[model samples]
Target: MRSLIRQGADVNAGDVGGFTPLHDAAREGHTEIVKLLLDAGADPNAVATEAGDQTPLLDAIGSGSIETVKVLLARGADVRGNDDAGWLPIHEAASRGTPEMVVALLEAGADVNARDAGNETPLHHAVARGTSQAGSVQIVRLLLDAGAELNAVDYQNRTPLHAAVATIDPSAELMRLLLQAGANPEAVDRHGHTVQDLARMNDNKMAPAMLTRALATARRDTGRSR
Candidate 1:
């Protein structure tokens, strides 16, 4: 690989997924291969046509490959690029609950509040997944600490709180966290339903009540934090 790169092989060549060699290495979690590609001038921000317009950094984030994420970011990867999937690297990281990737991207100058074509921020995606399998809560907390807007709405006017109830296990603790962080449950979506209303209809009993509490807390916090 080093020899090929030195011989002028395209370091940024893509395969069927629009994945560059860097993307491939990152997807495979090959830190050494990634280092080799980067040292050879592979464009960290290069998007392959086969990879659905996703950059190496975004691919790494989707796979939750923190080591590869670090390598790409260190090489000046654009963490904010929205691919055909309508997801930024931070969004992918948050969706997968890759807290390390989330923190790293933010620290590397990725916009925590950056919205995709759908106007969904990292925080919006983070709180949407109610499952405990990935680090959803951790991702949400990290976004909050990084000054993510708890009340930021998507194209549908759904807040992060609106998303938290859609996942499995319906993280009550995460709902509490977003509430404490000032998410507005009373804010209605494009469908004219509040986050609390969505939760109530979701078949998950715990999350709706928690969302209601969050709405109340948001009101209280607004009164007191002033």
Candidate 2:
């Protein structure tokens, strides 16, 4: 990269949508190329001229490249830089359920409470989409340990509990984890349906029963609080 930079290649130049070579290299996991570029004086936090919204840190987190993330952060990359969608690096890490990436971002000062444009926090993404449930659950536990807000709601007014229940018959472990993490089982969506209601609507008996149990626990907890 230094040789190329010495040859007058614009290290900071990005393609359309602001993707520079550094971004591509980071996404592609080219650690050597990334090191070369950084050593050659590439702007660690360079926002693409066309993509001027994200820093290399964002790309690193999105790609779950802990080495790249460390390199960028060591070179003074801004961990909290927002992309076009207002997603911070932590959000990217959480979405992918990359606990290593999440830890790196947190160590580098990524905001634990940062929300996207949709008002969805990292916890919301962790419990969504069924395929990532295990990873998401692990990520959620980490975030909760780090003090992520449990009662956060999304644009659709769905909480993390709502997302978990939307999955078809989620495991008892997952249900228990979310509840233990403080997910509100009674959280209502924009349509005014509780997670229990949605579970019943889908004929997912196990999920509704789980959510209902959570609700019962919460009610008892609330009564004690009063």
Candidate 3:
């Protein structure tokens, strides 16, 4: 490592997969080694062309180490680096359902509302999680707080609310959270389905009650303004 750097090892040299030393270290969560390579003139933004232009920062994220992710950001790893799927690191973090990882990327100015190849935002990814992870709800809240477009539709014209409603065993907490954030209950998807429509279609027994309550609240609020 240090000896090789001192001996003029090619820090940025890529293997057949275009993976540099920085990519390897970051992927393995070897935080110190990442720093050492970066200091030795490793290109933090070097792309693994054979691997969908995957950067070291992307690997750091896949490694699931906030420390390694932070080190990459500190060394000038571009948060906006494009991968094969048109996903930013934020998209990956959001789907992985780690609130802290999303927070780190958000703090580094990752686009909370940025669309991926599927035209889905980080919010879409968070809500589309079929099975809830530990911080899934918090991830949704974080994106909302960061100004994620709650109603932003994807290629399927499905908003985050739409996606949440269609999830198998959708969380009541998530349903309430989105409605509280002012998500439109009547918003339609590509198939012209509303939240209730999707709920019924999916046999989601939970979302209907919450959606009804939200609609009633919206009516009450509307009446007051009148």
lDDT of 1 at 35: 94
- Cα lDDT tens digits, model 2, 38-105, are 87777777776566487777777666667887888888888777777888778878876377778877
Poorly placed runs, candidate 3 (over 4 Å): 203-226
Q: Candidate 3 — which pairs collide?
A: none
Q: Candidate 2 or 3, higher lDDT? A: 3
Writing each residue's lDDT as its tens digit, candidate 3 over 45-101 gives: 999999898999888888878899998898898989979999889998888737888
Query: How do the predictions measure up, each by TM-score?
Result: 0.86, 0.82, 0.86
Worst 10 residues of 2 by lDDT: 128-137
* Alpha-carbon deviation at 222 in model 2, angstroms: 13
lDDT of 1 by residue, 137-214 (tens): 778888899899888888888887787865555776787788777666568889998766777788766766766676
**What lDDT score goes with residue 97 in model 2?**
34
RMSD of each: 2.8, 3.6, 3.0
